[model samples]
Target: MKKLKMWLPFVTLLFMLAGTLTLQAQRKQGVTLEGYVYEMDEDQKFPVPYASVSIASLSIAVTTDENGHYVINNLPARNLQVTARFLGLEEQTQEVDLSKQQVLDFVLLVSNFRLEEIVVTAESNKAGAATASKINKTAMEHMQLTSLADVMSLLPGAATVKSDLTSVTTASIRGGSSLGTAILMDGAPISNNANMQIMSSAIGGSTPSTSGTTPSIGVDLRTITTDNIESIEVIRGVPSVEYGDITAGAIIVNSKTGRQPLTIKFNTNPNLYQGTATHGVNLGKNAGSLNYSGDYSYSVSDPREGYDYYRRVTARIGYSNTIGKWYTNTSVSFLSALDKAEPNPDDEQDVTIKRQNDLGIRANTKGTFTFNRNFFKSLEYNVQFAYTDRDSYFYDEATNATVAYSLSKQDGAVLSSIQGNKIYDVNGNLVTNVPAGEESFIAWTLPSQYQYDYTVDGRELNTFAKVKANFAGDLGATHHRMVIGADFKSDGNVGEGKIFDPLNPPYRSVSYSDATQRERSYKDIPFVNQFGLYAEENFDWEFANRHLQISAGIRYDHVLNFGGGLSPRVNASIDILPEALTLNAAF
Candidate 1:
């Protein structure tokens, strides 16, 4: 049955070939013309299934689908003409020189614009112009977008600047740098740039080949569960004031809600990172929804690029009111450096080794409060926080040099080797299996770190907030449907590195403190604060029974060291059709 199924198509093709050959021999005339038709508007936009095309002579024609896509087969090897016509639209004709088994696509134009002075509006596909915005609800629903950079890379006016952390998170918008782009979760800004986003700062020790950071402010993208997201709004350019100082773009994500009924979902699939075991369920009173989903998986593969096999795990949970006005979202995810590929630390040595014992965590939470519609006027406010921490030990740094190493500790010699280790916590809790030096081998140093050693329990925090009005009045004659707003972001990191300095020890010997190299340690905490305001508006003009719309906005930002800045944006669309297809662009 399988073989027959596979050969059926070929058999049909062979029969068609034989028939064509015989027919050509019998009557010197044999021709087949085929093509698909698209009814385009005056602006050359495909209106999608609103028009019809047909061959008047032979009654052969086909219409397109909602996506403005179609395919027609069996065309001729000679010249052919096609006529396309739409109701309440202009009729058109096309001529083509057909070749053997060819496909032709068409673009038709409508005579009149779809939106005229009709005195009434049907449904707002979210616009008054004849052009439509491609709402990709399904696309967002299927992809678990992890970074603001990843989301913006696929949008217009923006190109993601990638690096070592592209998979973890790294991005740039338009001509602006990654740090220059404003990022927001809900309506609040995301800050703590040095850490909130991962940076490949060296692992400060003898083994400086690997990279990582102490517990610090990092964006937690894994917590955003696709199943829990209601919608993800991507603004590829400057957005409205209801936003803040972002010159490039912004992404507004709305989480799903109404958790009265219980539901469950799960998956078990093997991937490059790990095999996944995911589960999601909802539990709440009859009035609201409280949902939770978690994932645990393991992955180990020899990537062609030689990224040694390793492991990872992800999980999240969210809660909302079914009948009340309160909501909360909280989740945590982890990535332990199971292993990696590395080059030998010696200048004369050329070998790759597998590294292990790297670990990190990310956690976030968002809480919201919505007041009543009357006196409270539907006031709603939200807050979210994120964190990431990592630690590892491998050749951190190496200079070109060679040394002999056979001296004893008593031979007035000093020799030492160093390995890197890390302890990290996300949000507020420390993760497991961290190697903290023994209490007896502890000491203290300050400001920041490297040695003689002391054990530390540390934590870092980042906070974001959002506030919006259910109703906002227009500001003046410009139709400034103004949604005024501000954002508050804060980041804090505190910890110390233990350092071990030599003390008149043996010179050029390997047995001196062979297992104990940390000398002293100290701790330092750096925190940052930022704020901004934003605005946006829309304008429309009617001419020749068509509408020309212009959308514009601006943002103001105030960072700590970078001072402050303002960026403006604009988008326009002209109604070149009757139904709703516009020529749109934003800059």
Candidate 2:
């Protein structure tokens, strides 16, 4: 009985080895998969290049070539789920046995419904994904949005506020400052860093109420029209390293594209009237498409107060084309805004008239190049340039009873009376007045009820450029998509700032207690330059009947005067019940 027991143990080990060998032989019997992906048009088939073909179970994916031909090697000879997808088209999935049929072709159809037509409300991402919300054109139309600011109410935890264009409006996310949120239009930044519209505060020249411009805070949402927007995506969670110069969150705006019929809309409210026209034209065969849009709006604080009004006009032209393996889109836009507030006819004493004008032009080009290679997937680039000219004027009647003002750009107290009065220094020494347009360290008290006007002219320019490369491949059982990119930006202003008569400078207390305002030219300030480098990796792994997705990235930024800063981020999610439940975490 002892000898039989030893033989039985050896025999069991031999059987186990044979079973393992048989499993290895079955795995080696893989088949090659080759197919063509195309679209049908009136019973005719045309190749759909750059379409994605993937096997989710095995984490294998590939893109079709220019001829819509795709090939996958060493695929398991068993039943598998294959998916094919492309932009602006319906996705198709099928289950088939590779051993029986190696060549699997797909015919994709154009989606009949627009994304906005189906989504009537704000749509959120799945639980396991990043915290994001998307608002489409249909939602904006339904809400009768007059400006981009009105769209903010659609977000969670936000209350609807009546749309008003008479005042400057900015966006704030997560209770953070407006500067912390980054606003992007078509992947290009809408920067307000070089806005120097405020008058020299030393002379009691604060921001004018009718300026309608936000300086040092962020973009003024009221200036951005919503008629030409296609979609808006707000990211409240930790965003990808591709976005920088932000701490709270990001708002991405995508403009309309492709071929569409002409659309004209007119809207009227109690305080606002807006009109917009948009059209898209297809240039036939391989020529691509051209799009044009224009919007005009006028608003007043009250129907009876015609003296205070706001006017805005915007126009845009865009071109989209695909040449060879590269696809490019270029656009140019123009904007003009005017805000004016005049004195009422009944008020004889108050002659204050405030007017602000803003003119801007922006141009941008973005392109993508696809490559059918083992390691490299695609390359993307974007370049943008923007220029804005702002003019602010404030006119008021000053009635000083016994106030002494200074015209001296230097420090120390110098006092003078009306035009005929003598000037004196703080030490009670006699000071001679210089001729007009000459240097004089003296102060003068102006006549009562005189005209006090000052103008601030500021010209700002901004430029941005970025280049990124994407790579996709399989390493062992994991599929990875890696992205590496670098971006640079520059902002500067060159304009005559705070223009005023030296003889009758804005009234300010001549006492030592009050801070003095000095004349400063916008061109004197230095330009700001920023550079950033980023890298990110997104991977998917399937194990033990569960799927895991993780994204990890890091970024480095260097400012012209400031030192470099580094930021690291990670986000992970795991499916617990296939499509039913998932756990997500981010840092």
Candidate 3:
């Protein structure tokens, strides 16, 4: 009987243990995943189709449908890793515990350059190359950039200054003038070195560039609005040979393409108002896609106060497609802008008076082609046509415009004698008057009273074409990447200025006061053609399974107008504890 009781207790314990395990297994929860994948288009978000979704733990995978909806069932009740990937977008991963059904959404973005967390020591296009800084669309939205000039101030080693009188915005980099810094949209350069002004006797040579009294240089960014910019990159380090005419640095802008959804946005503040709309449509696998965008912005220093404001309107359309190993992208855009400024009545003066009514229009077409299985890697071409018309004049609100003076005597003398007030001409000559109270009399201090209007017209055309090829091979134990490219560019400008002359006497306006001012003009049209050929070779050797890396590159460039030169760059990285610590140097 003693033996039977001992055995019975052991059997009962085993049964209970088995029953507990069965109940636990039955109580385990199931995992089901349901969510959508979205792609961002400026300020709007829309679902994406055919995104690959996979779970590593369960060995299950699926693709999102046309509506960007995905559902996966029958996953284990444990922590699982899920990965989502799409072409032309950054891959994303998520962690989910299958203890219950989980709902998760993913957003994907596109970028021209990708870095997986590496410190840059030298100039390169790859990860950890040079001092390249990128401003993505998300960052652009957060910063609320109003114009291209605002972007320069955000970059390192660059300073921006705005002219309060002329409403011109320019930038200087690393103590260098704006002329040395190159601004490029896409792969082409658009530099404006001309300062349009009425080059005639009535206005004299009062243009910012030609006048010793004012400070304004290079292209004016105040007229460019930030509606269609997808991203911007600033290369602060030694740039590649592909970029030329730049002594300081370069700014590259990439416009939005057609791989996005439709979006609309409205933004406003006390001094600024903006509206934008963008849309994209997929035609077919063989036909490609279409994209369109429109943006308008109106900015004022103070809406309730003085006349200091500008308006910009821009529109863009693009098409992109891929067939076999060939991919093509083509786009066209137009810009219209106006900048105006009026000085306060008290601060207005004939010698230093500046009131600008600037108007401009620009149109450009750009096309790019990439070949995946060819000796030539890519080809790009751009054509730009633009015109600027300005009607700026010095105005005197204090004087009436109905005055008609006799041609025999100077207007200042006649007016002074009629008003019975002693007035001085621009030369400080004293005058005495006998009559009093004339309605049409204007003081000699009013500059606008002597001239009709100052007008300037400018037209510019630019074209760029380039071809690039890359080679990758092995040299001993080191890997070599070589890039070779050639580019040709032409820039031409034609403009006419009226009523401005710099060589005239100091008292020129007053000297001709007795005669009706006849407009004197000048024309200066400059044309420049630049051809460039460049080659770069990069060699990388690694030790200890990539724990230590040494990279070096040398570049040679031949510029048709600026001559030729050679630039060499070197970089190294040592991983101390894998992802935890890294030591790097570049020169």
Find the candidate with the highest lDDT and give its number.
2
lDDT of every predicted structure (CA atoms): 0.40, 0.75, 0.55
**Lowest lDDT block of 10, candidate 2:** 120-129
Cα lDDT tens digits for candidate 2, 471-542: 555455665566679999999899888887765555554353344457789999999999998777676788
- Candidate 1 regions exceeding 4 Å error are 1-169, 172-177, 180-192, 196-230, 242-247, 254-287, 300-307, 322-378, 396-399, 402-460, 473-480, 497-525, 538-545, 548-550, 560-562, 574-587
Q: Worst ten-residue run, lDDT, model 3?
A: 206-215
Model 3 C-alpha lDDT per residue in residues 1-587, reported as the tens digit of each score: 45445445533543453344334433442457789988776877788775667653222456676677877654445556688765445557888766653888888765333354322222243422445676656555555666777776666545443312124676566667787777887666766644445334433222222211111466666655566676677766555556666667677787765456567788777777888888777775446677788888777777664466666777788776544334455676676665555555565463333454545555555554433111122344555555554545442222232323331223344544244456687999865432344444433443333333234444445566666654333333444344556777666545554543321212233333343333333345456666765555444555565555444444444545656555555556677777678776766
Candidate 1 lDDT, 317-346, residue by residue in tens: 454332333444555444443345555344
* True-vs-predicted CA distance for residue 279, candidate 1, Å: 5.9
TM-score of 2: 0.78
Q: Which stretches of candidate 2 lie over 4 Å from their true place?
A: 1-129, 199-210, 399-401, 412-441, 446-450, 507-515, 576-581
Query: TM-scores of the models, in the given order?
Result: 0.50, 0.78, 0.61
lDDT of 1: 0.40
Instruction: Using TM-score, rank the candidates from best to worst.
Output: 2, 3, 1
Q: Which window of ten consecutive residues has the lowest lDDT sum in model 1?
A: 118-127
The alpha-carbon lDDT assigned to residue 170 of candidate 3 equals 62
Compared with the true structure, model 1 gives a TM-score of: 0.50
